[model samples]
Structures are given as structure tokens and as C-alpha cells.
Target: MNADDAAADQLPLIDQEDRLMASLVPLAGCRLVEVGCGPARLLRQLLQQVDGLECAALEVDRVQLARNRSEPVCPGLHFIEASAAAMPLPDGWADGVLMLKSLHHVPLDELDTALDEVARVLRPGGWFYVSEPIYAGALNALIRLFNDEGVVRAAAQAALDRALARGRFTAVSEHRFAQAVAYPDFDSFEQRMMRPSFADHRLTPELIAAVRQRFEPHCGPQGARFVRPMHVRLLRRR
Candidate 1:
């Protein structure tokens, strides 16, 4: 889906987190932390599911955090402004940690440190769950055609695999969720794709126009649709 459509049709806060939390049911009653929680959507929903289950979210961007302050805080929910590389919590404090759709922004060189931090904060037998996009098939070709520079989809998969191998966590489950988002029309699609956050590096007027042209033929009269594969994994500290 293009930016406006994405924003307008954004997943309902509770539904989105419920899907993620469903996979973590085994860890119910354990303290949970969410890293890189943008807009606090998932964090807000997570707080509703379990009573007295300590829930906290860490966001690196103060500006985003400030905007979230306008929203009422839920009971047992806490928001912290901090970097993922150096979580403020003491070691072995969290029984489960989550990072969803934010890993791509992390620099490749610092990935190890990020994983190290996740490993450090999690208690033995704790769970680390992550859900991220894994561009492949037609989507990979489309990204290459659009000259997207966010993350090499393949590299992201490889890095996560390597991190699991070297870090103290052991993989328990890996699943792929196919998400298809549709835009109302070309204009809507363009507006969404051109968001500063989505296309900060490689977005150009010419490239945007080209992408529109390339996907235009495929778009139904109503709008264009893009299918992207999302990767979800659950890991446990060994």
C-alpha cells in the first residue's frame, strides 16, 4: 500500500499486537519489552492482554515519543526514550523482547552490538521475537527496479541467521506472513512511497515516476497493490 493508504488502513492497534502476542503465548506472565516501538501501536495493545504483566517500550526517536505522549498511557505500560544498542534495563530483566519492522534502519556494522544488547537483557530461557519484511520474488525485483536503498532484503535474512548462530539465543520458530497492501490510485501510491521514513535515501522524483509507470499497468482501475513478505521469528536464550 502507498503511504496514505498505509496510514489510513493501518492495522488496528489491538489486532496487530494480538497476532504478534499470539506467538508468544508460551511466555505469558513474563516481563516483556518492545524495542523500536514506533507510534506505540503494538505496545498499547500488548498491555491489554495480560494483567500485571509489566510491559515497556523503547523508542530511539524523541520526536516520535513526544507525539505519543498525547495519547493516554495504559496501566502497566511504560515508555522509554533510549537506543536499542544500550537498553537501560538491567541484565536478565526481561522474559521476552520484541523488535518489529525496525531492524532495517539499524546500521549493518552495529547489528552485532544490537544483538548483543538483546542477549544481555534477556534472562536465560527468555524469548526474543522479531517480525520484519523480507523482500523477495516479485517484490525483490520491484525494489531493485525502484532502486530502494533501505536494506538488501537478502542481507537482512542472512544477518539474522548469523546473529542467531553467534548469539546466545536458539531459534524456536520461523514463519512468513504475506501482506498485500493496495492503494486507491497512482497518486495515493506515490504519496505513500515517498514518505521520508520509507524512502529517505533513494527516493527521487524520477525514480518515483518510474515506479508508478512500472506498476501502473498492473494496477486495477481502482488502484495499485503490492505484496510484500514479512518474516517472523521466535528465539529463546539457551
Candidate 2:
């Protein structure tokens, strides 16, 4: 077993950003790219805390991209509308590439090409941070009710392992942690999770009702809170 396979369930709950920042300290002042950045919430936080860090945030959703660009632009931060399979960035330009719970969303057929794009953009010894949601968890069970990701999620890991076996990257570390996810009610969950702009999760009336039936059980006055288990793999370019 490699160091990247270290057990994570035994570890206590902690903020994902805290774990990420600990490893990112060395990359301050270096170039970083976040694929499928979505709202770039974490990138905003990183820009605020890390000095001189240049960031390229890429997202495939044009609607979301417009919103991200409409927000105040931070120094050294650029937003691009792009996919992981074909990043427009130049070769060996980034010190680090991050995929925060986004790899599994890539088309299964393009997984290899996407990883190749990541490897292509990262300089030798550059880091690749992949944060994927673990298949087991209360939140995952609920999400799986409508949008089952078992196949894609498993494919994401398998692609990573293949890349490693091919000497594309050296395994560095693996971390598992549970993140706190809260939904003020079923509507909040439906709007955010079910109606995301990136993909069409076709929700018929029957499907919506079915999802609500399962989700309502977890709701209370303040709302439903579930711990989302996450698997983070850190690798270095070979």
C-alpha cells in the first residue's frame, strides 16, 4: 500500500479548506488552476489568505461563468469557461491543479483525456489535488436517490490509478474527512442540488416527489444537516 492509501475514517472532522491550505503553503506565489471551480468560493478564500498566488478558475457552465465574472475580480485571479478535458492553459504553467469534487462529473469517455490535460499543464513535481465525495454517507445516499454517481465516481478513481500505474504521477497522500452540509429544507436542496446549472438532472413530478419523500425525514426546524464524507488524493507530477 502507498502513503496515499492511509485510512481517513478514523480521523476527526475538520474543515476541507484547512486541510487544503496546509499543503498549499509551499505553493504561495505560484500558479494554481481549479478545474470545474463552480462558484469559486474556495478560490476566493485562498486568494484572501495566500499572498501572491495566481489562480485560473475554469468552469463549463456559461451561466455560472457569467456570474463568477460579474463578481469583483481579485488580483491574479482569472475565470475561464472551459472543461477539464481541454484546458486552454499552456503546458507546464501551473504549480498545482485542483479538482474539488468535480472529476466524477466529467464524461466517462473523456476521463483519460482530462487527466492528461491536468498532467500536461502541471510542471514536474507540481501537485494535483483531487477531492471526491465518498460513495458512502447520508448525504450521498440521498443524492443517489435521484442522481446516482456510483459508476462515474468509481471511474474517476480507476482513471487516477491507471494514470499512476502509467508513471504519470507519484502518489503523495490520501485524506478522508466528513464535511458539514446543511439544507434549510427540501426546497433548498432541490434548488441547489437538483437544479444545478451545469447539467440537466431531468426531474419529473413523480421523481421530485420521490426525492422529497426521502429527504423530508431528515428535516427539522433549523433544517437537515448531514456529514458528507470526502476522499482527497494528493499526487505529484512525474
Candidate 3:
């Protein structure tokens, strides 16, 4: 029950990459792996901002993986087609592992396996940084209309708690922050949110109208700006 756990609109809007870098002050020269990296946007930012770091971006989606590989490669950066539950990386290969808004997306039955895989790949005392979107706020409400994540998100947290309880990892830090997402219009929102390459929500005609009905009210002269509450947990592999 942290303060930012609530739908607090007043929370400072931050470039999450800045916060991530600040948290990962020791990241330079480290071997980092980002599991379930859809576009590796954050990884790209890190590769540019930090020096001497080797990063591997793992994605399970074929379409997104192909697109990532097709893109121009960054120095000290590579892409791997892999899943969080069963990473192809060798044991003790990573100095840090990241799961950004993707843990809850793992099959509920495989949540523990994914966490264990993270622990397996990470060296002793390596960092495990996980960021999950809180299941609250107007944006969550709109998204829930099509893809409700309440149960899976809770399960994700519970799995972490279980891992901590078992002494597989030690809690190093926790942070809560807000990131603002703006959609120029409903069309933009639909294109980005509803039609992602990962999961198929099966958007129907009636469903689209209903979603639009709820989303339109949030629009303004500047379009829709929604605060996405994010919870971050930094753990160390024991």
C-alpha cells in the first residue's frame, strides 16, 4: 500500500529512462538482459546514454523479433528471440536482468518459472529490475475494457513475494513513479493500444464503438493525457 499505489494524478511525470538510469548507476560495463523487450526502446536509450555496456534484448514474438533484428544494430547490443520463462542465455550470464511491464504478461502458470529463470541467468548478487503497471487509473480503466490485467498483475506481484520469501532473491529497493502517455486522438490510441503485435484482443465493431465511447470524454484540445502508475522492484539474486 505505497502512496503512488493509488491513482494519484499529482505524481511527477518523468522520463522513465532517467529514473531507470538513476536507479542503475552501476550499470556501466555490465552485461544486461531485457526479457520480453517488445521494441527495445529503453535498451536503445541505455545503449546511447551509458558506455561499455553489453545488452541483449529478448523477445518471444516472431514479428517483433524480426523487426528488431531488421533494425540497424547498436554497438554492444544484440537481439535474441526468447521467452522469459525459458531464456536461451547461459547460467550466470547477466549482471542484470530487466522485465518491464512484461512479467504479468507471462502465462500465470509460468510466472514462477520466469522468475527462476531470471535468477538462474543472473550472477550472484546481480540485479533484477522489474517494472509493472499498476492496475488502477483512468488509462487502466480504458485498457481494461478490452484487456483486463487485474488478476495477472496481482499474480505477478504475488510471485515476487513468494520468491523473496523463499530467499532466492533479496529486496534491494522499491520505487513507484508515474509516466504520462498522450494520444493525439482516439485513432492514435486505438492503433497503439488495441492493435499491438503481441496479443490479439480481437477488436470487434461493437467493441471499438464502446471503447471509443469511453475514451472520447478523456480527449481535450490537446488530446488525451493519462498518467500511468508504475511500480518498480529492484532485487538481488541470493
Scored by lDDT, the top model is 3
Task: For each of the candidates, give the backbone clash count.
Answer: 1, 0, 0
lDDT of 1 by residue, 94-173 (tens): 98898887776566776778878888899898988888765453444455665553455455556678878886788988
Candidate 2 residue pairs that clash: none
Candidate 2 lDDT tens digits, 1-238: 2232233234457665644655643767879999999998887887877788899999999999999989887888899989999999999999999999999999999999999999999999999999898887667778988899999999999999999998899998887777788999999999999999987888899999999998998888899987777888999999
Decide which is better by TM-score, 1 or 2: 2
Runs of candidate 1 exceeding 4 Å displacement:
1-17, 137-152, 197-199
The C-alpha lDDT values of all candidates are 0.70, 0.87, 0.88
Which regions in candidate 3 have their CA more than 4 angstroms from the true location?
1-6
Candidate 3 lDDT over 54-145, as tens digits, reads 99899999999999888897888889888889899899999999889999999999998999999999999998999999887889889999
Model 1 RMSD, rounded to 1 decimal? 5.9
TM-score order, best first, reads 3, 2, 1
